[model samples]
Target: MNRIPLRAQALGARLAYALPRPLRRAIAGRPIRIDGQELALDAQLLITLQRLSGAGMVNETPEASRRKLEASERLVSGPPIEPVTVRGLVLGGVPARLYEPAGVGDDAPLLVFYHGGGWVVGSLDSHDNPCRFIAVNAHVKVLSVDYRLAPEHPFPAAVDDAVSAFRHAVAQAADLGVNPDLIAVGGDSAGGNLAAVVSHQQVLAGGPVPAFQLLFYPGTDGTTRRRSRDLFADGFFLTSDQMDWFMDHYMPEQDRRSDPRFSVLLAEDLSGMPPAYVATAGFDPLRDEGEAFADRLAASGVPVVKSRQADLIHGYINFLGVGTRFREALSEATGALRTGLALSGRKGADLNT
Candidate 1:
């Protein structure tokens, strides 16, 4: 592995440390108060992300998704690489993207990726770079799904859309230039949750269960509050207050929170699921739950690899071009994906299916 230089790492850390105290405080805490009422961290982060997103910021929905997507976009853009588009008719709709890569011939294993945004934000455009990098680095085709978001569509709506998309991809594998049997599901945060749930749903529905699952700091259990939520909740990019806000906007009704389809951690059984590569960030409030979910999967006798990004915050995967550590983390992740996909004996299938 090519490690980042110490000086560069130090510079990145210093830059992170050098932000204005108030801005850092806001980045690390709740929103700034213009009045007596507390604005909360998610709102504050959204505003910060808006500034970072540059132009084309959408006014609808909370600021978190837009800002996160914008920051992610800026972090991953670089010189052009090989790009391919695979169209699939799913959920009575046509969805696709540019799958950039080198030596990604036909029959490469497919990675069906769902983008994260509290299940209310994120789209193919928001996560284009990461998907492209995964396609190129992992030597596989990545089918990035633009699942339906919440507020407008809630609960099973996202899951249903994801399942439909995955199934459609699998059914039309040949048309999309990949093997149907080598499909895997993956996502970050909320997208991670959807990937897990969708895999389980596929298993129950029978036929076409993903060969593997790649979950990055997934939002697992929605019921129990973990210790990390309080300990690392403040300074990290994702805070406990922000999580609550996301949950509020995402679930709204309390009844939906306990549904295993909505919260996979609440599921009664995790047996017979695909092997998993679970990544968590040390400073993230979602850390504990992600780790706990990995533990549960391990307990169920599934092959699992859990990695913690000690010096990073939430949503670091999307920052692959900004920091050396980000690329390192992405490389580690892609390596894991390659190993997992290879072990399934489906290597060389076009991944864009």
Candidate 2:
């Protein structure tokens, strides 16, 4: 197999090792203190921070982080894409981007995406490439949502916006030029959490349920501590410390931590949900919970497919041309969408052509 160059790999490892001992310890050992409260860090967050701190220091501000993302996008080659506008506003407001690929029809299936940033970061621009690739590869229109973030708008706000955006899509299906009945919801990390919650909310509200759910290393359980926390807590891009920071800024109130919308793993039931495509990174601390959620969904009779990228790390989906792994990940995800939309009975002329 062709591997990332040894020199690059070595450099990456060294950076991981160079993080301050205390910062590394905080990420790897002990619970994270957030707003004077001890919030136990999950494996995924721990690993994410370790990697971020190791490879490059964490961006202290949202703007700096966005710049890094913008710079990375300069590397990938995406297909012809166009944006669509979504109407009907809700709590977090209505902001959407529709990516139309080459040779796709007006009645194409749609993939609605939520960008990840621990509920506090990430936006439409931050995840543009991934959405474009999905639209092009799956031959479907991709609608990406820009939901409100936190410490400004906490729990239930993001969830509310996601559901609203989804409902707007369903209600204005013809206007958006797609088969409204054949929509899928997908996101990474916190965005994944939003997708799952929105799916549940839509089903409960008797709205159109998405045909498929694509979650990449989702934060399924915010309350339950898992073994992966201790095992992969350090040296990953997302750290337990950063997770605590995010949660504190995003949730704040401890009482709301167990709400199923915030922690889907704690939801009372998982039956009758749409088929799912869950992707997990081997080095991701969120790995276990994401897989566990898929297992639960499968056991509940949801047609679920789980892929664990053994050599890749968290946030690989947004890395674009940094490594071939991101492209491979996008292809697999879009393939799942193709099969998913087909099963849902939506047919675009180019779906399989």
- Tell me the TM-score of each prediction against the true structure: 0.78, 0.77
Error of 2 at 77 (Å): 9.1
lDDT of 1 at 135: 86
lDDT of 2 at 101: 77
List, residue by residue over 1-353, the lDDT tens digit for candidate 2.
Answer: 01444345434533544567566455456644422333223333334433443333236765565554443333232322444332422322587877777787888888888999888877787777788777878888888898988867787888888898888888788877888778899999999988999888877777678878988889998887777665567566666766777788788887789998898878888887888999987766788889999999998888999988765567777655332445777688889889888877734435756
Each model's lDDT comes to 0.72, 0.72
lDDT digits (tens) for residues 1-353 of candidate 1: 01544344334434543566576555646544421334333323433442443322233456655764554354344333455454443434736553636676677789989998788767776777778778878888888887777777767778888888888888878776776777899999999998999888887777678989989999998988898788666645666776777788778888668898877887888888898999987667888899998999999999999998765667777654432566677789889998898988644344434
Q: TM-score for model 2?
A: 0.77
- Number of the top candidate by TM-score? 1
